[model samples]
Target: MAHEELNRQVRQDLRVTDRTSHRRLREQGSTSREDLDAVLRAGFVCHLGVIVDNAPMVVPTVYGVDFVSRTLYLHGSVASRSLVRAPESTVCVTVTHIDGLVLARSVFEHGVNYRSAMVYGVPRLLTHRTDRRGLLTGLRVLTEHCAPGQWEYARRPSAKELAATTVLALPLDEASVKLRSGPPDDGDGPDAQLGLWAGVLPLRTVWDDPEPDPALTAGVRVPPHVSGRGHRTAP
Candidate 1:
């Protein structure tokens, strides 16, 4: 299907369902596929939560979201037991961006301004023993997602290095986005007259000057894509 058609279909399909998850905070939750896309695309890294052994684990890793295929691609060492087992069962992938600190009048009212999404699905492993081309493509996309200009700038991975890597794809069919923003909720409460200050302290991430490796060549200039982003907002 065309990208536009897929988006429309996904959105329509999402709306017809009850759209409730296990989250207790229903008011902050959203079933919009667009919101899931936005949250995933806006961030490159995610937390992969799965049950390894008898215990739960949340592994932080870089990821790429392909809207065309509606899959979330994850990469890690092939030797990792967690990576090996991720494709065998259902897992939850999450991406979150902290926008600010919500400082309320009462300690109990303190909270955070954040945009987050959680995806639940079983993953498909792509390796040299499986689909090699898909593995490379997923790795390239993952690199580009995390470091935009570095994929093309660096040399391609060798066969030996490729053997050491593993790629996993999880469909985005089951996902939800939850976001909380703006100021404190206690401004209109009885505590409003406490005379204490209470409001949101906004936070943001920005790209700073790039530092060259000390062992690098002396005359090489920083690339435009790497250098020009100083002070620019980050996803």
Candidate 2:
């Protein structure tokens, strides 16, 4: 009951509103906050859609999620034009995980099995004069988002490096998640009699054996978490 209550509360807290509302193909939409969280946690990279010079720009960058604050953090260069323009305007951040290829009898019916989330908000830029802790937290999330156990194993960033980086946090209050995963829709349709091949070919991202830095000292070995994901699909 406790878990149920928490889920209910999260749902209420993250209820989708206008603008973030799903329209066409509503069957592929999910209102569950848990689903949104899962999509965000599955990937570290996100395409940040913003307007620069009155033109649309979609910049691919690393991201981190602060579920506690209902925020998504984006990392970019301090001098990046898109990053500079983002804070001044409402930006859209999209994260997607492709699960498989959905092959159908008809080409028009073919699609991809994917989980995607789109979030819109005004971003908060973290700087030395602003929220330094937010930057640190964002970096931590970015590191852990890419691969768990890496943050602990890696060297910490220095002041100069932090100064060169920009962290932008966008609230997750307005977002939409759309996903599709299943056998092809044509499986039982008129095309079924065509006897064409139809099914899902799953795809996975995995960590291969670690390649040490060329400058590393001899005798070092791969860590457990690094090696444990052998042939294992990475989130």
Candidate 3:
């Protein structure tokens, strides 16, 4: 999507407006649906923020996004007060991945290198069965990010289980992305003599060996995707 179309006219006042510093990086923080979808698809976990009783509450949960529909799907238990209280208000969804740690010669220059995306919009309740089914598929995409084949192997949710869960669809408008990478900047004259180890310590997320359920019958093989897993793509 075009930048103009994605951010034609956003509200002047929003929580993200304050968090959005650095105009150049903010522009790099794309509002395009494709960018948002890529960030969402690259990972399963996200931090969801909503107001409850006029106080800010942030909860970590799984999320999925549909670029075509420009919708973000979130799932939580029916008993979750955060979801119940957030229907009428705008919410912020954030996805972040720490790529590396930047260690400088001086302690003051130390920082974390990361890639992150933030999305803001009002969440709408899903009612129509067709839309609900689509949202459920998106949810499955999140739940099985590392192991795509598990969606079929795992027992599907029953009717009662579905009813007890709350699924929310939020628009993909009013979003931003930010990223920082590479080594630290130490001054040329003063720090040249301090031969300290100043470089990036890379971090990565990988799949560990699968642990099957203890009660499972013997001879059930692990799924191909899980067995042949490797490092996930960074957002």
Candidate 4:
């Protein structure tokens, strides 16, 4: 399906509850589902926050989104069930992209230009015995999201590998999206008379040239999908 049609299928608005309500900087908060989708689509990495052993734990992981289903697929660990052990537990997944540094004349006004999204839900774990298709689909979505066309170019997971892997699906129904961009907000404030330079220092991440392994076979060549990513900005 076309990207536009997929987006049309997504819920139009985000569900705002007490947890998602912005108490500060309400102007930065967003209720549009498209804003949330944009934040998620702009990055492949996310931080999964959940309670482990009665203690709060936050783990960094890669994620992919299924806009049609409004699902977020996350990579998990089979060894550490902190993510999937408790079937009834809720989790929070957050994805953020830092666009630049907002430099203001005053220290107190210094800020960051970023886009962030936080999703809260009870994750549904996909396992071989339970939902094999979902497991593979989630993994494929994750792999492609990180590196387009790599899933088909690389070896797929075997039955044994699939059994040892863990993947979670979380609904994007309840999420909070926030975006901060442009120049410093103190431009018209009292600090304007300070005569100090104030502007935004933009940041960008790009993919470098593909590095081949020392042990790579002599006949092997870098695929177009891999080599073409060189110098391209990352999502």
Candidate 5:
């Protein structure tokens, strides 16, 4: 999407009702749909929050977004009570990645710096066939974001399978993004003289070699995307 469109979407989505002292929290935040989309695209897993039986339930699931439609799609088993109850309730979806572990001279100053995005919205059930198709496309985009070739090589969902799944679409509004990076903020004092190993140990997500199904034909070769899988530093 265009940068201007992303800025507009962020303005519409982020509602700032409070203030804080941290410069990172106050200034380095964004609500842009593009920013959210980038965050979503960088990772496939998201934590979904909803109320079930008057209690809060947070579940982890895969998510995808449609930039043109401004819709986010989530799917799970039709028999999942959480999925059934979530559509009617307010939901918060969060995606985060830990970039590194910050080791400081002082134990109190140690922290894990990371990037994260949170989305708050009400979900609607995807009932129309056309809408469902769009959602499925979004799903494909999500699953194959890193490995572009997998969407075509993998088995596609059938009509019967689609019918047995529950997919929800939530508008990309009322969200926030916060990120922190770099070394610990240990002041120049006694702790600085401790001479401890203080720096960052980077973290990364790597894809392992793809193992084919044992019952499959022996001559099949792994798809390019799958065979060439590599590690990427999360956000």
Candidate 6:
């Protein structure tokens, strides 16, 4: 019940700022925190947009979210310049899931069905030596986000390995959420008289059967967490 109330409060209108305000496609924009969480939970990969060396750089990386703390965790190699420099200035993290292609009678009316979220903030870097606990937590969240149960099932990272990793925590205080779904809008327009077959081509992601490494022992069986994942649809 407490969580429910907290959710209700968070679901209220999100704090809108110049960066988060919707200037166009106002109909598809959402200010509800629930909408933002849905967009983040639907995918693990995100594009981190930041300025590196005075040039705009976009890096694709895996991410995880902790709603309780209202933070987004992103990880990468410590040697990566983009990750290192991201803390120097504000950054934008975007996650998008393409649901379908909206086929319309007219070319101008054609569009795509997608759910997207953009978060803007100045992230704080978590170094393994200085912030081991924070780094581990971030890594676990990231690993589990990509492959549920893998973090506990697999061996934990060693000190050297952790030292080479870079983790960034970005607050979820400011964001923009937009979702577009359903059929083409030209159905009731003049283009409707064209009699063209216009509809949505839906897309889905699913996990395939797991393949074992060649060096693995033949008698070893697949873990339940993994074997059960096969043929399952991804969010």
Per-residue lDDT tens digits for candidate 2, residues 30-118, read: 88788899999888888988777778878888888878888787886532446565446888888999999999899999999999999
> Compared with the true structure, what per-residue lDDT tens digits does model 4 show for residues 46-99?
999988888888899889988888899998863138755666788888899999
Question: Model 4: runs farther than 4 Å from truth?
Answer: 1-11, 78-80
* Candidate scoring better on lDDT of 3 and 6: 6
- Per-candidate Cα lDDT values, in order, are 0.81, 0.82, 0.68, 0.88, 0.69, 0.87
Assess candidate 2 and give its lDDT: 0.82
CA RMSD of all predictions: 3.6, 2.7, 5.0, 3.9, 4.3, 2.8
With a 3 Å backbone cut-off (N, CA, C), the pairs that clash in candidate 4 are: none
lDDT of 1: 0.81
Stretches of candidate 2 off by over 4 Å are 1-13, 78-86
Per residue, candidate 6 scores C-alpha lDDT tens digits across 150-217 of 99899999999988888888999999999999999988889999878999999999899999999998
* Segments in model 6 whose C-alpha atoms lie over 4 Å from true places: 1-11, 78-80, 83-86
Writing each residue's lDDT as its tens digit, candidate 5 over 1-235 gives: 6999977765656565333122465555765456667777778778887777777777888777766777777754331356565446668888898888988888888888777788777787654353676557655755565457878888988877666656667787667787778877885768877777788998887776677989889798877777776443334
Each candidate structure's TM-score, on Cα atoms with residue i matched to residue i, is: 0.88, 0.89, 0.78, 0.92, 0.80, 0.92
* Tens digit of per-residue lDDT, candidate 1, span 1-235: 6999987876655432334373576778777777778888788888888787768888888899777888789875421466575546778888999999999989999999999988877788888778899988898889877777988988999999888788888888777778888888898899999999999999998988899999988898888878878888987
TM-score, candidate 1, is 0.88
lDDT of candidate model 4 versus the reference? 0.88
lDDT of 3 by residue, 124-215 (tens): 75533536675566557545663577878888877666655666777765677776777886746477579877889998876666688899
After the best TM-score superposition of candidate 1, give how far the Cα of residue 61 lies from its true spot, in angstroms.
1.0
* Candidate 3 off by > 4 Å: 1-38, 78-80, 83-86, 127-135, 144-146, 187-189, 230-235
Off by over 4 Å in 1: 1-23, 78-80, 83-87
